[model samples]
Target chain A: MSGKSLDNRRVQKFHWMSRFLSGWAIFRQSFLGKIGLTLLALFALMALCSFIPPLVDPMYQPMAGVDPEISTVTGPSTRHWLGTDFMGRDLLSQLLAGARVAFMVGVSAAFMSVFLGTAIGMIAGYMGKFADTLLMRLADIIMVMPALVVLLMLAALFGQLSIWFIVFFIALFRWPGVSRVIRAQTLSLKHRPFIEAARVAGASHLRIIFRHITPNVLPLSFLYMTFQVTSAIIIEAALAFLGFGDPRTISWGMMLQWVWKTGHMFNAPYWLLPPGICISLITLSFYMLGRAMDEVLDPRLRKEGQTD
Target chain B: MGNGKQTILELDRIVKRYRTKGFFFGAHGQDVIALNEVFIKILRGEIFGLVGESGSGKTTAGRLIVRLEQPDQGKIYLDGRDITGLKGKASKDYSRRVQMIFQDPYQSLNPLLSVFDTISEPLIIHKIGNAEAREDSVWQAMKSVGLSPPHDFAHRYPHQLSGGQRQRVAIAHAMVLKPEFVVADEPTSMLDASMSAQIFNILLEMRRRLKVTFLFITHSLAAARYLCDRIAVMYKGNLMEIGPAEEVLRNPKHPYTQALMDALPKFVHSGGVKRYETLLQAEREVSGYVGCPFFVRCKVARAPKCSREKPPLKKLDDSHSVACFYAEPGIKTRSGGKA
Candidate 1:
C-alpha cells in the first residue's frame, strides 16, 4: 500500500496489458489466423442457413426427364448459382445444406470425444497404478479396432445410421487417440508442485484430477479435438458414401452416392462435381483450423514470436 | 500447549526397503534398504536438519514422515497421536499440517496454471473461505513472499517467472495453509548460490514469524550449519550422529561427521583450519569397505572392530550423541583420540 509499491503496481499492469495487446496484434497478423477466422465465419454462415429454409422451390425439377440436356453456358445465374445438378437442384442450396450437416457432425463428435477422452485420461494418469492399468488397456483395445469396420457393423445392425448415430460412433472411437495424448501430458503434470500443493491443501482426489490436472491438459485436448473433428467429418462422409446413411437426409456423401449410382459422372459431370468439391472444402477447412490451433496452443510455436 | 506435548513429530526405528524387479526373467528381486532403523524427534518451533550424501535415505525419510511413502516398519507420532497407518481423511489432515517443498522448482509447478489459481486452489478445496476471501488470502500469501504487486503476479503464468520468483511462488503456495510443520526436501538445491541464500533467509524469516517447525533435508553440510538449530548426519540409511549443530560441527565424534566437516570448503568456515587434502585422502581409503557403512571412508577407523560391527548411537554428553563402538567410556586409541 506504500506509494512506491502502488506506482510499481501501475507499471506492472501497464506491461501486462501491453503484452496482451501485442499478442492479439500478432495473432491477427498471421495468415493462418485469417484462414481460421474465414473458415469459422463460413461455418457460422452455414449454421445460420440451417435455421433459414433453403431458397429452392421444392416442386421445381429442371431434370424432369431421365437424360436432361447438359448446359455449358451456365456459370452463375440469378436462377441457379454455381449451375444446376443433373437432378436440377440448386447447387448453392445443396452446398449450404451440406455445410450444415458437415459442421454438425464435425463439432458435436469432436466435443464429445475431447470431453470423454480428457476426463478418462486425467483419471488414469493422476490415480495411476490400478486405475491407470485398467483404463489404458481399454484404450489400447479401442485404438487397435478398425474404426470404419466397427461403424459398418453398427450401421448394419441398426439397418440405417442417422447423423446423430454416426456422430456418436465417431466420437466413441475418436477418444482413444486423444486419451493417449492426454495421459502422456498428465503423467508429467501430476508430479508438479501445484498438485502436491493441492494434496497438502486437503483437496480430494476428484478435485485434484478435475480442477488441477484438467486445466493443464486443456490446450492439448483442444488441439486434439480440432483434428478429431476433421477425422469425424471424414468418417461420416465415408459412411454416407458407402450407402449406410439415413435415406431421408441429403448430405454431400448421399449426393455422391446417388450421382455415382445414376452414372452422372459419365453423363452429367456437374452433378458429381458440386458434392465432391463441397466435401473437400469442408474437410480442408477443419484441417487448416487444426493446424492454426496447433500453432496457437503449442508453447514451442509461441516462443518463436520473440525471435520473429 | 500441555506438558509432555512438546514433541510435534517423532520417528522411532523407521525402516524403508524398496523391492526392485529382477532383470530379464530372473527369479528373485533385490531389496535396497532406503532407511534402516532411523530415529529422530522434532520439538515444536525447532529447525532440524537431516544432512547426508545422495542415496543416504534423507529424502526417503522425509517422504515417509509425510506418508507420501509408507515405512516398512516403524511408528510415527504427531502431537502424541499415532498416525503410522492412517489413511483417507486422517492422512489428508496430517498432510495439511505437514507439507513438503521439493527440489526442482521448475518441475514442481504446474505449467498450465496461472499464479492466482495455483495458490488459491488449496484454499478453495479446504473451504477455508468464500471466493472473495480466498482471493484476498492468495494475494496476502503472495505479498508475504515478496511477490509484491500481487495483482500482477496473480494472472501471470509460471513460465513467465524466474527461478527465484518460482521458488517464492512455491513457498507462498505451501505457506498459505498456515501449516504447523514443513518438510523442505532440498528446496534450495535447484537454485543458484545467491538465490539459495535468499530462499534460506526467507525460510528463516518465516520460521520466526510463524513459529513453524521444519525438517530441512539437504546434502550440503554448510547449509545444515547455517540454517539448522540441530543437525542429524546420515550415511547409507543410517543415522550416524544427532546433536546440537555447534557441538556436532565443533567437536564431531563420529568419523563420518569429521570427514564431512573436513571436506567443507575452508573459505566458508568460521573456525576449522584447512584440512582438504587429509579429507580427500581419507575418502579415497574408505571407498573399499564392506563392513560399517563409513568404515570404507573413515581415516581414524580401527581395524577388525570398525569394519566388523555396525556402530550404535551412544550418548557422549547431555545434548551430543555419536554412533560408533569406540564412543564409549575410557575407550582410547593410540593418539588418545575420542572419536
Candidate 2:
C-alpha cells in the first residue's frame, strides 16, 4: 500500500515537471521571450552588483557618498568609470542601484494589484446581479482616469512622496485593468459544469469562490501580472523623471532628473544617457515578457503542430 | 417492484421558464418554457428513467429534483416534505441527502482537482470523518465504481483519464456521501457503447448495494429499457406516458411514445415487424402554447380536438398511465420489439 502511494506521488511530480518543461519549451521558441529573459537577467546582475561598489569604496555609494576630488560633472576616466554627477555621486553605482529600484517598484506594485484585482473580480463575477454591476461600474470609473496624471496631482498636493507610497498608488490605479480581465475570465469560468458540481456537492458560496474559482482564474491573473509590471515600471519612471520622486532613493528617473537639473543633459552624455537608456530597456524587457507569457497562457496563439 | 412502495421524491406541477436578456431599455424577450406544469413521483429504491428528445425538458426535471434550479410554480417534495424554498443550512442539509451526476464527463470534473480530491470533496463538506476515514471512504467509493487499486487512480487528474474513467470518478464523487436520492443527467451520453454498459452496471451496483433511488434522464429509449424499473416519456415540456419499463415497451399507448419506439433502429433482415405509423413526416405549423405538445408531429392527432385542448394523463391499468385523448390501452401489443 505504501509503495502504491509512493508511486502516486511520483506520478503527480512527473506530470507537473513535464507540464513546466513543455511551457518552457514554448517560451524558448519566441525571440522576444529570449531577449527579454536575457535583459532581465542582466538587470538582476546589476541589482546584485549595486551592493559591491559601496563596499569597495565609501565614495562609490549612489546616494550620500560623494567623491572628495571631483566636485563637478566630468567625463569618464580610469578612476570614475562613468564619471560623477553634479553632486559628485558615482553614476555607475547610481545606475546599478536604479535597476534594484525598478525591479522593487515594478514587481511589488504588480503583485499587489494582481492580488487585489483577482479577489475583487472573482467576487463580482461569482456573485452577479447588484455586486457585479456596482464593482464593474467602479472599475469602469477607475479605468478612465489617467494613472500618471492622477499620481502627479496627488504628488503636488502632498509636496513630497515616499517610495512605498508611489508603489502603493501605482498598484491602486493599475488594478482596474487587471480586474476587468480577471472579471471576464471569472464570468466564463463560473458557468462551467465543474462549478455547478461543486455547488451540488454542498460547497458554500465562499468555498466555491476560494477553492474552485480561484485555482482556475489564477493562471490568467499571473499572465496579467507580467503586463502590469511593465506599466508600473513606466509609471514610476515617469513620476521620478518629472521630479515628483522620493528624495532619498537613487532611481534611474532620479538620475535623469539630476542630469537635466544640473544643465548637463547635452554636455555630459555619460551622466545623462545611462539612466534614460536603463529606464527604456527595463520597460521594454518587461513588455516582451508579458507578450511571451500571453502566448503561453492562451494556446490559440501557439502554432498548430506544436501542441504536446 | 415499486407497487405500494414508499415515495422518495416528488415533483408537483413544476413550471420553469427562461427569458433572454433584452436591450438596456424596457424591451423584453419572449419566455421559453423549459418545464410546463410537470408532475412526477419517484418510488424509493427504483431507477426511474425520464426519456425525451433535446429541449423536451427531461434534463430540467432532473435539475429541479437536485435543487440546481427552483420551480417557477408549484413545489418539490422529498420524502413527503416540501423542499422547494430551502435556504442556507436547510439547502446544505438537503444536499447531503440528494446529489447529482452531470452530463459530459469531460466538462463535469474540475481539471485542477485530482480524483481523490474530487471524491473526497463531499466527505470534507459534510464533515463526515477524519482524514484517514475520508481516505477510506474515497477508496471504497472508487473501488465500487471499478477503479481498483485506489492509490493508482487517486492522484490522477481528469485530463489524464479517459472519458469512461472520468465518468467513473464522477460516480464515485456522487456516491461517497451515501446519498439516498441521486439525479444522473445523461451520465453515459458522451461515452461509447461498451463504456456506457460499464457505467450502467456501476449504477445498478450502487442501487443494489446502497438502496439509493435514482432519476436517470436520457434520450435513448433502448438504454432506459435496459436499466430503468419505470420510465416516463416527455415531449416538449410535457409528460406523454408513464409506466413499468417492460409494459410500456411491450404495449405503448400514447402516439408520441409509439413514435419514439418507431424511431429506434431495427435490423433490416427482421421479419414481420409491426410499425406504429404514428408520426407525421413533416411537422405541422402551430402558433402559441395550446393543445398537446406533440400535436405538431403526431399523425394520430385529430384536428379541432388535439389542436385545441391539452390531454391530461389518464390511468390505463395498474401502475400505467398515458396522456392522449384517443389512446387505446392493452389493444395494440407492439410486435418484434425486444426488451
Q: What is the C-alpha lDDT of each candidate?
A: 0.76, 0.88
Candidate 1 chain B worst ten-residue window by lDDT = B330-339
> Which candidate wins on lDDT?
2
DockQ of each model against the real complex? 0.33, 0.63
Q: Which candidate is the best by TM-score?
A: 2
At residue A301, give the lDDT of candidate 1: 69
What C-alpha root-mean-square deviation, in Å, does candidate 2 show against the real structure? 2.8
Candidate 2 residues A1-308, lDDT tens each?
Answer: 44544665677688778777888888888889999999999999999999999999999989988999989887788778999988787889999999999999999999999998998898788888999899989988999999999999999999889999999999998888888888888899888988888889899988888888898899889988888888998899889989999888978888888888889889999988888888889888988987887778788988777664
What ranges in model 1 sit over 4 Å off?
A1-40, A43-53, A56-78, A301-308, B1-5, B24-28, B112-116, B129-143, B148-156, B268-290, B327-339
Instruction: Give candidate 2's iRMS in Å, 1 decimal.
Output: 2.1
lDDT score at residue A293, model 2, on the 0-100 scale? 76
Clashing pairs in 2: none
